[model samples]
Target: MNQQFEHDDDIEPASKSQLKRESEELQALGEKLIPLDRKQLESLNLPDKLFEALLEAKRLKAHGAIARHKQFIGKLMRQVDPAPIHALLDKLAGVSDTHNAWLHGLERQRDRLLNDPKALEALIGEHPDLDVQQLRQLIRNAQKEKASLGTPKPLPMKAYRELFKLLKQFNPEPPIPGVLRSDDDDFDADE
Candidate 1:
């Protein structure tokens, strides 16, 4: 009975030591965020052009695509970082007060665009190519193209969407204003 008890005590200590070692290994693994290899990274459902962008991030201050690529890398890092990822998942957790400030600014700009005649006039003055007459003429041309029979025609949907997207990106709304409580009916304001 004494021999059996001694053997049982030895087994318990060995098992505890093994558990501690395994726990430490897991903690070490969690701490190291390894950069995935090309084939392994490709397995992730990222945009097809992402690898190219990442390669560009290796270079400094490459304008346009490079800036965009750097932004992409930031996004990728945020995604991979357990801390940021958790904060993003939890609405109450890691909040960007700066982003909130920017949103508020955007809302103010949007209100200015809507209510201030001078601002609207300025935009029209700057982008004279986006005149209402020109818009109407383009719509008419698109309609004519669509209506034409025989051999399917390509809609200038690409050009129209690209133009509108660029305009919206350029003239983004400011974040919420203290005075302007948004209503469900106001789509542009809500946006």
Candidate 2:
């Protein structure tokens, strides 16, 4: 008994039910990754085998094949750190407070760009990587669209949306607002 206890001390063993729940959660995460565009998938920096698996999953249309592929992807996920993946997915889904704030900021900035000519200069200064010419064209088009809105035959609101999308692509990630999650109240074993 003493020898057996010595082998498993200092760590709480997980129950079978707990393990199953974790597996299901990971499988769900993998399923979410399947629908992501190539750019988003590449940003995850997944391992080559896992990346190929995801691409293959995307191509699969049969229900049974997709289900089995998700299980395989879940197996692959077990080998990778899921924290960053979770963070990126949450940000993309706009579920987190910071991501939602970032989107609102983009909307405000788009308004600023429309109302103030100098806003474009300031934004370009902040994000040097932006395609300045395309941005300028989009801004010009949005401005024209807004100006024509009151006219009898106004152009449809295409550029306005395009401007917002462009701004979103170039905007920086939002800063955390220090709101703690309710789950933070969970007991910490380290303590």
Candidate 3:
């Protein structure tokens, strides 16, 4: 009896219901994996068969086909341990860390604009919806304040803070679902 199991032979085989629950959990895990990019999937170090199956699953789109393929993934999952895979997924999804790296990137951009005149054009190119005049003013103000102070250290001036706030509003990352203050769908009226 113990010979049938890999981890522990003393433990009895799981009941049918418990087995079914595990299968469903693995299927759910596969569903999450489907949305991840190829690079992320490759980083998992999963068994080759499972990796190929996942790639196929991602390539599939038809509803019935996807349903059947997901079942196949669940079967494949049974042959593998899920703990390490799940830990990697959590790290990629920013579940384990504060995920503040994007914020730091934004700050770097802000500083770049302050230092280089050409940076404004690049920023505008990336965010076409930006109010160029307002941003130019903020940059000018921030620059003046920086030049006025003899200290080499950066200061938290009003314009510098305002620029960051404005930049934050146009963050490229999709906002978390259900985070809106109102379910208004951003309805706006034209003049």
In candidate 3, position 143 carries an lDDT of 90
* Per-residue lDDT of candidate 1, residues 1-191 (tens digit): 99989888777445788866755553332222123334433333334455554544555464686545554554444334234322222212224453344445655544454346575567668777666555444444534444453447754444333333335555543432221222222233222
Per-candidate clashes come to: 9, 0, 1
Q: Choose 1 or 2, whichever is better by lDDT.
A: 2
Residue range 4-69, candidate 3, lDDT tens digits: 675575778799999899889998888778776666666566678988998998888799999999
- The positional error of residue 175 in candidate 1, measured at the CA in angstroms, is 16
Best by TM-score: 2
lDDT of 2 at 175: 34
The window of 10 residues in a row where model 3 has the poorest summed lDDT is: 182-191
Tell me the alpha-carbon RMSD of every candidate: 16.6, 10.2, 13.5
Q: Which stretches of candidate 3 lie over 4 Å from their true place?
A: 1-11, 97-191
Report the alpha-carbon TM-score of model 2 versus the true structure.
Answer: 0.61
